[model samples]
Target: MSRYVVSFMKDVLGGNGRQIEVCQKTLEIDASSEGEATELAKQKFCKVEHLCEWSLHADRIQIKSADFTS
Candidate 1:
């Protein structure tokens, strides 16, 4: 398993069809793949926030491999 960072993002639309992604929350997870990490993060987030859907809290999700130096 690899460490991944999952982010819950909120999107804002501006003038002329401009879009911006604002990160609302981030989670560190251990998963075999990026897709798995995203799924796990969403489930965990929803459970912790007492929501039935992950979309209720954020517009989208982003995941990346976490780089750590020891």
Candidate 2:
């Protein structure tokens, strides 16, 4: 298994009135492939009840997968 960085992105206007992609959450997953890593991320990474910041600024949640095969 290899390491993968899975990120959940949120596009929102910052305090400066500029749109930026904010990483709501990120996880390092040890999986074989990108697809597997993404699946693992989705299954394991979930929002906590107390963590409402992600939900508030996120218009949409997008998952990104990057493999660390080195």
lDDT string, candidate 1, 15-66, tens digits: 7689987887899999999999999999999988899999987998888899
- How much lDDT does candidate 1 score? 0.90
Q: For candidate 2, lDDT tens digit of each residue in 1-70? A: 7777877777878899999888777777888887888776666655432443444534444444554345
Question: Worst lDDT window (10 residues) for model 1?
Answer: 12-21
Q: Please name the candidate that would achieve the greatest lDDT relative to the true structure.
A: 1
Misplaced by over 4 Å in model 1 are: 12-20, 68-70
TM-score of each: 0.78, 0.63
lDDT of 1 at 54: 92
Best by TM-score: 1
Off by over 4 Å in 2: 47-70
